[model samples]
Target: MRNQLLAVLDIVLSARLVNANVIRIAEEAHKAADPHLALALVSARGTTTNPVEIALDLEMLDAAVDCAKEALAEIEKIKRVVSKNVVELEAAPSLPGGDAAMRRDAIQENLDEIDEGFQICGARLQEMETVRDIADKRRKALVARV
Candidate 1:
C-alpha cells in the first residue's frame, strides 16, 4: 500500500509540475509578446485550449494533494497503533525462548516496518506539498497577469 501510494504520488507530482511550468511559460510569453502574437500563443493557434488545460491541471493537482494528505494521516494512525502495541509488549515480562518473547520480537519487527513506512510517506507528502506550492504560485502569478 505504501509503495503504491508513493508511486501514484510521484506520477501525479511529476505531471503537475511539468504542466504548471508549461502554463507559466505560456503566461510569460503572453505577457512579453505583442497583442496578436500573445493571443495566438495562449489560444494555441486560435483553438482556445490553454484555459481548459490549465483548469484541468489545477483540478488534478488539488485532488492529488488531498489524496496525499489522507494517505499521510492513515500512515500516522498505523504508526500510532503499532507503537502502542510495541510499548505494551515491552511492559510484559518475556521468558527466554518462550512464546511471549517470540511475540515481542514480532511486534518489534512490525513497529520497525511501520516506522519505515511512516518515513517514506512523510517524505513523499513533503515533496508533493512543495510541488503543489510551486504550481499554485505559478497559477496565481498567471491569474494576476490576466
Candidate 2:
C-alpha cells in the first residue's frame, strides 16, 4: 500500500509540475504577445486565423490547470487519511473496541480506497499528457509564425 501510494503521489506531483509549467508559459505568452490583443487582431483580420482554434487551446489550458489543482487537493487528502490510518494501526488495541478481525478489515478497506485513488490519480495524469500535447502544438504554431 505504501509503495502504491508513493507511486500515485509521484504521478500527481509530476503532472502538477508539468501543468504548472504550461501555465507559466501561457502567462509568458500573454505577456510577450498580449494574447488578448492578438486575439482581437486576428478577429479584426476576419479571415486569416480562426479565433475558435485559439479559444479552444486557451480553454483547455484553463481546464488543465483546474484539474491539476484538484489532483493536488486529492493527494493531500490521501496523505492525511493514510497518515491517520497508520497511526491508528500502530496503536495497541485495548479492552474490546478493536479486535484483530476489525483491524484487519479496516486495514484492507483503507488499502482498497488507496488503490482506487491511485487509479483515479493515474488516469488524471494520463489525461494531462493529452493536454500538454494540445498546448505544445498550439505554442509551436505561434513560434513558427514569429
Candidate 3:
C-alpha cells in the first residue's frame, strides 16, 4: 500500500515536469522565430506555420519520454519488490496443514496482484516507446529542414 502511494506521487511529479517542459518549449518556439516575419506572414496570409514550432514540439516529445522513464523506474522498483516477496515466501517453511494452505493462498493473491500491475506498467512503457519513435521521426525531419 505504501509503495503504491509512493508510485502515485512519483507519477504526479513526473507529470508536473512534463507540463513545465511544455511551457518552456512554447517559450523557445517564440524565441526561435522572428516576430516581425511571423507577423508579416500572418498579415499576408490567414495562417502562418513556423518550422521552429516543429522543433519545439520535438523537445516536448523528449520531455514526455523523460516522464515515461520516471514512471518506468517506479514500475521497476515495484517489480523488484514483488520478486523479493516471492523469494521470501518461497524460502519460508510451511507450517501445520491449514496454516500452510492459508499462507499459500495469501501469497498467491499478492503475486497475482503484482503481476497485474506489472502487465499494466509494461503496456504503458511500450506506448511511450511508440511515442518516442514518432518523435524521433519528427526530429529528423525538422533537422533536415533546418
Give each model a TM-score. 0.56, 0.45, 0.48
RMSD of each: 15.9, 12.6, 12.7
Model 2, 35-114: lDDT tens per residue?
43344334334433443565554555555545554554555555455545545444434324444345445545554555
- Which has the higher TM-score value, candidate number 1 or candidate number 3? 1
Q: Pick the winner on TM-score between candidates 2 and 3.
A: 3
- Model 2 clash count equals 0
lDDT of residue 20 for candidate 2: 48
How do the candidates rank by lDDT, highest first? 1, 2, 3
lDDT of each: 0.50, 0.48, 0.48
Q: Residue-wise lDDT of candidate 1 within 1-146, one digit each (tens)?
A: 45534543443344344334434433443333233223323333324334445455555555555655565566566556655555655555553456445555665665566566557555655655555455555556556777
Which candidate tops lDDT? 1
lDDT of 3 by residue, 1-146 (tens): 45544543443344344434434443443343334233333323323244455445545545555555555465456546555554554555544355434544554555465456546545654654565455455546556776
TM-score between candidate 1 and the true structure: 0.56
Of the candidates shown, which would achieve the greatest TM-score relative to the real structure?
Answer: 1
